[model samples]
Target: MKPGILVISHGSREAAWVKLVDDAVIAAAASPCLSDIPIVSSFLEIIEGRLIQDGIDELERQGVTDMYVVPFFISSGSTHVDEIGQAFGLPWLTDLEGDLGTFRVSANVRYGLPIDDDPEIAELLAANIAELSTEPEKEALLLIGHGSKEKMFHERWQEGLLKLGERLRALGGYKRAEYAMLLPDQAAAKLAEMQAANPGEAVIVVPLFLSRGYFTNHVIPTRLTGLEYRYNGKAMLPNQAIERWLERQMLEGLQRLNEK
Candidate 1:
């Protein structure tokens, strides 16, 4: 009845995107502390043979009686996260404003939180922008993400990013920190406003995506066509910090179970 770690992500057809997640898991699994554990990285969709259920089945096949599901998403506001919970026969949503409630699974399930405004994540953002910054004190930081149009869902993005923005500004010493969303088509306008508000200050665009896929590869560039800004198109992946984040979550879940 040993525990296994199942990392769930929003899948993509892009081989590169899938590889990023796989590499992160591989790196984590290589760690001395986790080398003995059964760690499988799976996706929600778009991969050929790997899906959430496939991951669950794999863990069960490995003789895992307790599975820790680490949802590798940008925000808990994602509808996909809720759907994944329901797919496992867990309560869909007892409280939308708070953490997505735990669910009942074939195996004892321990769910982990999404990467929402964690200080480590904020450090990643600052690092991405720092590469393009000449004078952070004169530049504006614009953090963009796949935001929701729905009222409550959008609020989640706003609140999370606002905290992240504050953290990024503090860490990077930027003149100001701001946020833009793609859902309501506010990214373009927001970028323009940031520039207008601080004339001559460079704007560094940081994408808050889990991987460098379609949106980061194409859509974001397409959307920012007319604007002159600095961006490296880096997504959160292949970072050891993420593996540490997953480990910390798994330990917390394990501790709760031990207490009970």
Candidate 2:
């Protein structure tokens, strides 16, 4: 039988967002090379059924010797990815043991690169901005991300988005593009200022988030609703590029397991 593929995400309380990720993975699996393989997903938090270990156990039960666990993360730099790896105690491909106990049902897991890493991601954000902005010259785009308290992860996210903003500015369409965090202070106030400066023009509030969970669906919209401007709520959707990248990583993980 073909190896089973498990796409693991941090999971979310938002059922619709979870369905979005599920749909994206299913669509990707339709590719001829991956069609025969069984592909499933589970969350680390929220929503139950197939946790990380459950995915492993299911694959093992099926007599499937090869398994691929791909974290649908936007960054390899996140602590969640590191923690997940440590929890599994599965060394990456380079250090696999050849014994059946090790090889019989070896898991090949790869944490994904962040969405900000993709060049096309900027384009996607820009497209959303265009849809929100009625008057480009007077409007501003505020990209809000879930910033981490951990210095490294937070910095990486900040840097990545900043670079994305720079690229968008180079394209020379939007008048102003800036990033903000959910953590820290005065996010709503900052957005208000942008609206104040723009006067009559619209303000596009884009959440640089993967899924529409508590933060994206509830908190963000609630906060922005009070703000003065044309609030065009365009949350990010799962796209083909993200799915393809995830599948490629899964395939690579499988290949590495075979070598061991």
Candidate 3:
């Protein structure tokens, strides 16, 4: 029986955005190492059809003896990732062994490892910044993320941004690289502040989100216009390194399951 691979993500209401993630995952699965694996994707919330259990059921039907679930989130500190794992009855302390009555299916699930952690991710961000900014000297890189009310997750995002900024600074090409949160303060206001700090310099607002949705498509563009700032906007979609990261996590999960 072929081992099943499930790419799990926080589902979005926006169809186009969801399709973009799906397409990215499909492309990732097409990697030479994972091309033959029976890979499927499902959402933890918001979207329909293949919820976590639905994906599990299909995999079982296909006679899959083992499964690997990789969460497509930017932060490993998210509460949703923990809650989703709990919903599947796999607590943080327990091993990945699922009892399905007639056919026992062993499973392993891993949560977020921020894109910024990947070495290639910094290059991707820099490329995006270069594409958006015509004047490297006058332009500033603004990384915008959805902050959490909870301090833990919020701090995680902040730290991730700082690390990424450091990497960019080490590259030493951009005028400045800074980060801001959408939850704590309005993105528009933040952008305005950034523009004011560096007059005549363009800002490239990169949504530090895994997938584009309400924030990337509507809120960001609207806010840029409202703030009366010259800006460039783009969704932080997955790149080649992200796929390798996912695969590595899957392999690690499989190793843990084998040990058990």
User: Relative to the unseen true structure, what is the C-alpha lDDT of residue 22 in candidate 3, on a scale of 0 to 100?
Assistant: 82
> How do these models rank on lDDT, best leading?
1, 3, 2
| Candidate 3 to truth, TM | 0.78
Q: How high is each candidate's TM-score?
A: 0.90, 0.76, 0.78
lDDT against the true structure, each candidate: 0.80, 0.65, 0.65
The residue-by-residue lDDT of candidate 1 on 72-175, one tens digit each, is 89987676676677666566553433232333347788777788899987887677667898898888888999988766668888998899999999998888
Deviation from native of the Cα of residue 90 in model 3, angstroms: 4.9
For all predictions, the C-alpha RMSD in Å is: 3.2, 5.7, 4.9
TM-score: model 2 vs. ground truth: 0.76
Clashes of each: 0, 3, 0
> Candidate 2 — which residues are off by over 4 angstroms?
1-4, 64-66, 75-78, 90-110, 170-172, 192-202, 238-241, 251-260
Better of 1 and 3 by lDDT: 1
Residue 102's lDDT in candidate 3: 26
Better model by TM-score, 1 or 3? Answer: 1
Q: Tens digits of per-residue lDDT for model 2 on 148-255?
A: 556666777678767776777555466777777775544688787876766765666767767656776677777666776554455556666656666676677667
Model 1 clash pairs are: none
